[model samples]
Target: MERQVSNRYRLIEPLGEGGMGVVWRAYDELLDRTVAIKEVRYTGVGDDKRADLNRRTIREARAAGRLDHPSVIVIHDVVEEDGRPWIVMQLIRSRSLAEVIREHGPLPVAQAALIGGRVLDALRAAHATGVLHRDVKPENVLLADDGRVVLTDFGIASLEAEAGLTATGGLVGTPAYMPPERLNGEPARPESDLWSLGATLYAAVEGVPPFKRDSWAATVAAVLRDLPGQPVRAGVLGPVIMGLLQRDPAARMSADEAAHLLRAAASEPAPYGYAAPPAPPPGPAGSWSDMTGPGERGPAGTVSLRARRRGWFLGVPAAVLAVAALGTGGWYVVTTSQSATTPTPAPTSTSTPAPSRATASPTATPEASTTPTTPRLPAGWRRLANSAGQFSIGIPQGWQAKKSPTRDSITVTGPGTPGMLLVEWTVPDKPVADPARAWVELEKEIQAKGEFAGYERIGIRSTTYLGRPAADWEFTRQRGGTLIHVINRGFRTADGRHYALYWDTTDARWDQDRHYFDQFVKTFRPE
Candidate 1:
């Protein structure tokens, strides 16, 4: 049997539940659309207190409804039914940031920065409207399947224009993420929210809240007394995180300063082992190209062939390539003397490859061919199936394929050129919805971080590929004093699989070898 609220919204199922409310997946009978309804329940309260709580719930919902920001959740309606308030909101198909961290371990530094920036944007918007989100933690941040980083669950939000709603001596937010001032019985200020944002980002990159303790009282004590543990994986985000977690709200970083730093960190190329470039000189938004001067290189300030590969891998997810471990002579060696070989077993977490070389089959077996529905490969190209990565691609005759240690990607290299073709399929639980926008954001980070020496961009454009949404990113960069041309195509298939096909070659030979990219894409197949 279904439950109806105010004869308009029909409850479908419970999406989630908290101590005070249950959120439902509901359908609006009047609007003929799906929406989320949060049923707020009050227990163990007198009649007068219950009425006051109901009034506060409606006021908060109305205040949240007035907020207009892309990153803020949309509040649809507040309905009174069965002597309680049902707050309707936009139905978002996504997982919380906490769930993502739990499933994938800690996020990459750049990824954490990007998510933090979006969440902060929402907080700033709420602050502008005098709506203080009392709870800003990983559990309240949603990574939507449509590529939106949304801040939600403003149920306990405090409106500046209104009187205090919480009872005396009662803290309203999670202790681990609460600012010290808030724990000391201070009012909720904008800076307190910034402190919470810092803690959320800390958890995003380090996989745990900064002040987490065995019990609530201990967590509160830790927040008030102990300094947070140093973040090891925060990389460019370390300073920002530490700055926001300051005990004195007055001494903490301002929202504008934090925004600038987060933007810079989000654009950084690699999370570790490199100092991020200084924040670009203040300019119009989206003017990242003006940051670097001529001959000004990235953090390391030089671009070797191996460094270029390392930077590219770092830009993607779950990249575990140890480029520095592969010495120069070993990386470029053409294994022509080796005969036909069997597929090597996939490397485990503790596995270590020989320092000289990783094993790779010289040719594809019969089963590696594309399905009959797809185009056949050219005479000289062979479709190689990578069982570990669960994908097949066509490569030129002389090129050799090396699988990544994590078995999430395969890189094909040829005899003489420094160029290589990389295919990666390490999709996160939340795949990108808009590829073109993603590339634009990535380009900003790459340029701001100065990862590419002598970097020049052609363009990033959205297009349709193989009857699916796709984007093409083309650019040129200097590698070992030789100009290199590169184009990367990313798309999500109908069955929700994400893949990237990247090809790079010398500028002089780009036109000559460009057909190889077409052949590779034509014969590519995802298992």
Candidate 2:
């Protein structure tokens, strides 16, 4: 939008879209500078709730603003626009780690370890200040064009010693990258993040997350029960991945240990003629060695000058909050001493706990980069042809598809998932020639009814789908505990029947699960 918000930040162009909100490359009219503006378009909540969330967003921004580490993204200001909060931040021209993997394939082993180590440095600094970055995934890790591996999105972070906002028993975090304890709804410790870092590194080298599955529920089960498929590509770092991916949080590898392991695996020579520092002994002694400044060394080993100057990751894992529950939107995070509220989930299958899984068996075939750009069906997905011979679509195996004939739609539901895919068709009021405007009226209908709360129309635009004129509407809504992202696409066939496909995914799995919708569109055939 050319229209300015708060009389200062003017929207330039969308940099990215997510379940939370859209980030725009913006212009600051007052200062004549470029910045990134995040519009928090939360809808459906009451006035009081919105006000609380607004206050919390400001608090979170202030917390992040206090962090002066080089790897943390800087927050500039918080503004109120249209009764919602907007966060203005430093706009680093960068690509996410996820994007890098998608384009270049898996990184070389040493390079992956080095990146992971740098990220650990940032996390250590954040932990030192009592900030728990509750969400740590590849998407949150930014690889700046300038070689800066910055960690962004503390929107869902928990400040230690504060009341957590999440209701008891609610789940948080992206399931695939979450630690085992967090997946079971237990609190996440710093080691939990280390586990996520390990998973991220696993994906960095092996191409897919350690616990990926077709549905969120199964993914959660896998995280809790199954060991990640062994990684042949991990090479020297394979043992490190296994150490960090420990099923028991209490038994998980410490950040310093993991970092040291990464450094050893990195094996690149230090510019100042030193090797990676040894895993410090547990106590104040080793902690100081890690925090020592340029050219400092422990009594036994020499620390790198760069590591000393750059403040390398603390080998000792700091004890932070184990679990973070949100208040409304994830941006408003709260902390708890323990994350014991997660219900004990049933076993996934007959698989035993895989503490020694990587060493125990041969690696399974690795899944490719999970960026979800192509139309190919992932393994284990099934194709279903409509009984009426109208079309066929790919769906995750075991998901139940039910027809709602009166609504002219078919809905697919996973066993324990709230996400859904809906396909609907109806005879147009008359012979509709152009599909572009066919669904514009429906978009207007939704806009008028205020059907979406925190409703920001990402956009409603005309496009071509499979050589047929089509219109697509992308928008986000916040409903109670769930932040929902929706893609609604309408297609007009030559037979005068208008068909629409609607895909809904929760913010937690939005990036990972949206691919199925694409596969559906690719596989759809109009007969």
Candidate 3:
């Protein structure tokens, strides 16, 4: 007979056991779903102290329940039975980061950085709600099979609004990951949590904690008195890790700076001559393809536009010509005389003249000289400012600009040019989480529907631009019987605004004109 708790949760098996509790794989009869239940227990204490511990467990669990983030484990229910609290939580099918490192050795620097970023996101969310995760270590991080890096086990968390719960003289975190201030009997601050995060990222890439020692006492001493050895494998994450591990919390790196550096590290290109292992076959039990539903392969940091809106990027309609005739100073439009012959695609290589090459261009022209506020343009290049879109970019001499029909995007083209550059910013309701993954999903949808004629993919790579996560998608497709190469970069602003920069040229001129795309990206500035 299986043991039942609160007449709702049925214990299936013990998942793991630790000093404070035993986590069980339990079945929730009422919800008809699997859940994880942690049974809190106290030993070597008198009845009065045990009762106090029970109350603290319930309070902490309730405090943790207030947190809501994609990277945070959800707390479902907390109940007391037989003088102890049981915390019911979302059951994740995954292994802890500690287990992964132990079994597979150290992870790659980029992978470690990615995991660290997710954990930091969760920490920021919790901190915003006045909760501190007192125990943040490899054992508390869950790498879910569904490509989620989740922070779990908030059993020891503390609420800033509440008074201390721990007994008069007791520490409540793993020694190796604890900050120096915490060891010196100081209260845990947000920066203290950052220190632990740094230690966690170090262990993730080094296979050992920065302050690991032979015993608990030695580890505590090392954390409080000694400096950590430099991490050789940390790569771009080395400074971030060391900065967070500073003994003086006041001198540590700020969260914003850490986030920027982590994103940069996560987006670092693979080492030279390195090749990714082939993805496993789709039918495997734990394969990502098998876990996700059709067209839902996790956050790809990209959103799909409605089918009718697809033409905004591929073809310019008559409505755009009408917008040009209005002569609005903000509208980048081509002349009406050239509208008939111009294919006017949002931006790409086509036989027709580009919409931007008209004799009468918009008021926003290339910068004649540079100011401290304005980015300097290369020789023969000019800055084009779009007041309506609140963005500015550098374009080569003689390049013209045209506004899209929706007025949310702009296209620029040069005289007799076979290539065009487009800047778009029509973000949807939901923001993308992974830009590279979004491109992969988008590619599948387009290919399945045969949208692009003779389309072939080159690659979709993760990267960072403007200190934010971004991705670059490169491909080739047939346009008017001519092969054209295209690259589209998508990213979100710090304030959640999404943008994409697209450029295309005929295959014959791709090598010569590709530099324009790079220059455009380098000079783009969003107001």
Candidate 4:
């Protein structure tokens, strides 16, 4: 491999490795200076995903390079060499706060407040620049040898106009330090960063994060449930930490309020009584917030609860968990929940070839409910035909039908539900492959990601559909204490291509949604 990059910077010794890429302390021969170069290499990613990674990398560099603050690391140059992005940044000699904690336990109250204050300054600058440091943790906090603090690693950061790589995919960022809503599939927000900052400071003061647990599932549960134990060691900074750690971003301490408190806490002496936050009443772990009005929509972060649930770096691809958002269709659809062991699926149903085109009525009539075999449509439902004319089906009223650009799929969505109907099909030049094993393969990958809670396979088996080989799978996902259910039916067509009809909805509404799902499946036509 070539060591010289951009025909100027020469690679020297390495600095560290992270999920996005590796940082190296290099020499910029052209500029006659030493610099930190971050190399983001997408090694075995598919073509479909490679473009996304490139976009995300360039966005990250641009986001970080725009910030002009002493506490924010300076970006010297950004060059694309070998189809990989190399970000040249200022070399800061320092130790991560994580190192400091491991070597000497938590910092003193004043010192922790001081460090947090400086980080807040960096955050303020980044926010002003329209940059969100999505991955803010102790390891990203650098304590320079010459008395300076800097925030590093804007890898998964989000900018004003750019959607995060994992925006619609699986959860991103460290679950342990991530805000609750993001874990529940919400978008990253400035307040979410604040919650992470609170978690970092809490660790600085208590040696352990307030919600540390033995496993990912347990950790997320703790974040959504337990309030941080009143910091016995936080002294004057205790209340400030709690305020920043508020579970709801809307109610969480504002940037100005938090900055003021941190500055004061840095100079204050230890105060006496520490008030414990009230333990939440046991019920559902997640609560609905920021209810949307008719046509207006909210950002993905509205699903957030207050707890600062953060996770470490997870190099995950675009995954479809709550629904069948993965793999174009075929069989990659699923829902999740927390379960100690995988449950055995019930017996398989007999095969039945469905009609190519069936009648669709725009009514939520419950014609057949005694048996799930003959599913009925919800009242006021209407028929939606794809613009490509590849297929058509009945959709519930208010549900929008969107034709994907590829002419191979359509997604039906509604405002009231978090689920959708996904249709995927392909014209094939080869023989059809087994459809049942596609779900099996998806299950393997989903389990391998291992970042889910309430991930339980409800059912799966081989079945015939529309005069072709077909398979069906159902599951539930309960992340951050909210339950979602998924149902997918995929089958091979005479042309060797596969088609799948996927549906997802909240678990609480599964019974109602399933009826709607049945009408669409029964009336689906592959023209």
Candidate 5:
């Protein structure tokens, strides 16, 4: 081991101790960042042991960073300091899903689904990137502050390591979360992960895994030969739980399919429990004490009946409670009439005035908001009268736009080397290239630009444009030799019509136009 290790990180207090490592709260000196540094001891063991440990540490770091999904914990860096290996991860101050369940028995079906969906999404990304998370237990899943599930701990995750890196014998995962295939020493696969996710969800909804026993061996036997108990019929997670627990991995649904179903279930009306923190208290128009206090007839902090009925945040059931208060922004805090277990104090005061408009008649849930039929320009994006819809934006005056013969839309370009803006329209029944294949093609385009340039491909996200089905894509590519990069956004409407836009410039120059990129995505309306 070397002295003091790297100058960048100052190791702080020990967070927790593990079988092979200890996690410390460390301050990153170089980046001025706070991160968790996990230190694994490398006693004067054989070279094989040291190599295996190093490989495990490096593999975990690579696997976690490879997944860009929000539901996966972010890995910052991995380093070997003074004869010991340490991996730094984002320091999240939230309870693990396992601890949360232990504190509050079983979670409601809706909450479980919300947490489950996010984990599955991360798994989808991991599998697509050729990593198998062999471990998917509750302890490894964190419940983020924003109410999202983040999967953690890939220390034993299988990856394409060199020949000397394999951990022989029982080097897999927790028995409860390990699928039968993995326990049998068979190769781990995506289906095995789905089985673990099912077990995690089962515990979330039923307060126990289908097979829990006093002895570890008994538990293993039960997992291999027995069926678990049924989850409470409190919500729509019933079928989903059963499907995930199927013994045959082939019978289990893929992570993507499971996520879609979970999202659909979360969208429906139900007796959902728990509260989402108020949307960052709209700039504090005034204090909760000043507005509605001790004894008020109409509940304070609630939205007007009209606004309540309008629904917000995935139609969160509490939105309809209607506790009216005065504020310029639309943030909600509970009144005395609401839950009695209020935790935090009311927000501060603000000067901005609330909008004065006739409340639109109550409509369907927010999720059912009208979809855009075609891309229409969003409010406030022009010198005057810009016709390209929200899905479109103005580029530097010299750039040009040309229609793609194969695609229904346009491809814009500028007077330069090999760079072009590609756009295409999609309609129902017409199949777009598979995402994996599209990524391959995009990789080719990226490699052609430069050897070390980086590119990010955001997933196909669903959004309503006006009142039709539409999806938006953002592709950011960096090129060599120039401090510039290219950004392209494409939209596909419900009817299968699609449009794509691109921008090419150095990063420093593009900073001036970065805000437009966000507004472009939000305001895109399909007419």
Candidate 6:
């Protein structure tokens, strides 16, 4: 905040602001390059306080610099000038995994596993160097634009351990993502990092924290005593969640085992691109390619230009939705077609104006466009509502919602596999708001009545429905190419509390009809 702090690093734009300090995208005149400068905010304290704070800052940077792993975000320098401490580090250009999953739902299994494995790898490196990350969450793990995972916010918490850096009794990490040991006041260690990683993976797959509460005290209670509703059964990840939530720190899986399991999970289909590099890193001759420069030869003496041009086609299925709205910005859709050959793009139309945010003109000046806006939806597609029964939400107009053959639910056919939408409404005489209890009963009921077996609950959260509170759950099962999307909303009417439940799948050529399905869910608000 002070101009010319130490008179060498010139502050530019602020990158991020946190309780401890403000991170600025700064220019280092001495180094003649751009770097991230973190300036500490000292409380109203005297000289003795400032010196102690500076010492801790140096210690953190020094400890982090000792780690020599690609997975860890590099910390370049730590400088103390005029009673304040500043840290210079590499600037990562990527959105946090937290931001990605927030815009979408849970990540596909591959991406989650890939991210989890890398975080564990980073943890191993930090522990090997006699240091703990102390904080591990989606926000701290960045998926760089270059498709690499970088662990950040290391050892910064230690700076706050000094009296001058932060106020006493301040919570240093994200609450829902904090491991139980951290809540219990135990010093962070390798096991603590494991716990945080587990929480992060859980949040990544479940689309929310494993343990959540509306109030702070309630959250603490949930973390200490509550069992999270089984997460969306992400095939192999189910067992991993069980291991991560172990109350006793010693009972949890080690970073080594977790990483190994993640690699194994990468083989299964879910969402997100977390698959390990191909047998030869997508290069020729079955060896890692050296596609380093603009015009250099890659593996097998092939021109690197070939690989660079083909990068967009790799692992990207056909029919991808790339749509932009005024206020909502961009959203993607992945759809599968009827022939099951070509993948359909997800619906990304921004036709419905965003009432919550401002909108820009359809065509902004090209010269003024520095950041590229996501493309608009293709012509002629219309959004519709999901009208199966009491479950009425928006959907694509032409897609058909038909009753399931089993007579228990209705399936809405879209253009692709990811495009199909299913809704089923079930009424229970006695309704319960707790997801764990509801899951146990629902599992038993589905097993007994539904045609499908092997049904498993993933994660559940308490949310409001139609102006009243309700519970939502995600499940995984053998749907014979059909993925069941179910929701149970409890409403108190003249007949007492009752539940509205439904299930759907993307088994059909789902992409043709996916835009409407996602929009239906996104706009679904009980009136």
lDDT of each: 0.65, 0.58, 0.65, 0.60, 0.50, 0.50
Could you give candidate 3's per-residue lDDT for residues 231-321 as a string of tens digits?
A: 9998888999999999999999887788778766755543311111111111211111111223322211000001112222111110111
| Local accuracy of candidate 1 as per-residue lDDT tens digits, 1-527 | 89899899999878787777888888898988778889999888778888888888888889988886656788989988888889999886667888778767898775677678778877887888899998999989876533346788888887988847655345668999999998898788899999999999999999999999999999989998999999999988999999999999999999899988886675454323111112212222111111122332222100000111222222332211112113432221100000011112221111111111222221212122222464455665556665433455666667777655322356778876666777755323222224555565556655776767887776665554545445566777886677888777665443333467777888898877776677677767655
lDDT of 6 by residue, 302-347 (tens): 0010111211222222111111111233221111100111112222
> Between 1 and 6, whose lDDT is larger?
1
Sorted on lDDT, highest at the top, how do the candidates line up?
3, 1, 4, 2, 6, 5
lDDT of 4 by residue, 333-448 (tens): 33211111111222122323222222212121212111123223345655444423344465655666665432235677887767778775421111112344445555666677
Off by over 4 Å in 4: 164-168, 269-527
TM-score of each: 0.56, 0.51, 0.56, 0.50, 0.55, 0.51
Better of 1 and 5 by lDDT: 1
* Weakest 10 consecutive residues of candidate 4 by summed lDDT: 300-309
Report how far off residue 177 is in candidate 5 (Å): 1.4
User: Could you tell which candidate, 3 or 5, scores higher by lDDT?
Assistant: 3
| Clash count, one per candidate | 1, 16, 7, 31, 32, 46
lDDT of 1: 0.65
Candidate number with the higher lDDT (3 or 4): 3
Q: State model 2's lDDT.
A: 0.58
For residues 368-466, write the lDDT of model 2, one tens digit per residue.
Answer: 212223244456565554532255566665776665421234676786556777765431111222233333444444456565566555555455454
